[model samples]
Target: MYYHWIDTEKPAWAVTEIRERSRRAWNSLFAEERREKAEAEEKAEQERELKEYYAEQHRFFEEMGKKNREEARRMEEQERQRKEAREAERQRKKERARQAKATEEAGDGKGKYPRWTQ
Candidate 1:
């Protein structure tokens, strides 16, 4: 009795189709990995830019604060000088009035000159 075996050879078209499917699957996986990597890089760059922006804003406010303090100090110094000048003027006016009163009270010849000359 002879035994019959089934044919096990694959067709040429079937082998080419299998190879094409495998190539497509590997290409899809590689594309997905590249996309994920790009997204991660973009997120990191955005975070770095945000941090830099905040730092710049902080530095600007600090500079503004320092400038305001210096301006206030300068204004205070100017006011103090003005007050000193006003006080000096008042004192000078009082001294001049006192000297005038003293000169008027004393007669012209009797104050600083001899009476014989008049």
Candidate 2:
């Protein structure tokens, strides 16, 4: 079947050429739209992956900070206990020295020689 333009008596070859051009233009436009859509989807997927990565990193750092704080508290407790033990040891030594001095004084002015010897 021969297609003819109703308004203009164009040659058959010109009509075929025009139809081919129009079809090609439409195909090009649709192709560009598809490419743009694919690119946008890819960009959104990349952004989602980046967000998940950052969230994981944040969680890791938070856990590390918690561990560090716990360690610091443990160390502080250990130091406090050590200080208390040292203080107790010092008090015991002082008490022993005071008792020894009192005993020596009680032995007579001969300085702990025995009561019989004095």
What lDDT does each candidate get? 0.90, 0.92
TM-score of each: 0.74, 0.77
Poorest 10 consecutive residues by lDDT, candidate 1? 109-118
Give candidate 1 misplaced runs (Cα > 4 Å).
Answer: 1-8, 107-118
Cα-based RMSD of candidate 1: 6.3
State in Å the error of residue 63, model 2.
Answer: 0.9
Candidate 2 residues 1-118, lDDT tens each?
9988777788899999999999999999999999999999999999999999999999999999999999999999999999999999999999998887777678666646655445
Residue-by-residue lDDT tens digits, candidate 1, 1-118? 9977788789999999999999999999999999999999999999999999999999999999999999999999999999999999999999998876776666365557644334
Candidate 2: which stretches are off by over 4 Å? 1-10, 108-118
TM value for model 2: 0.77
Provide the lowest-lDDT 10-residue window in model 2.
109-118
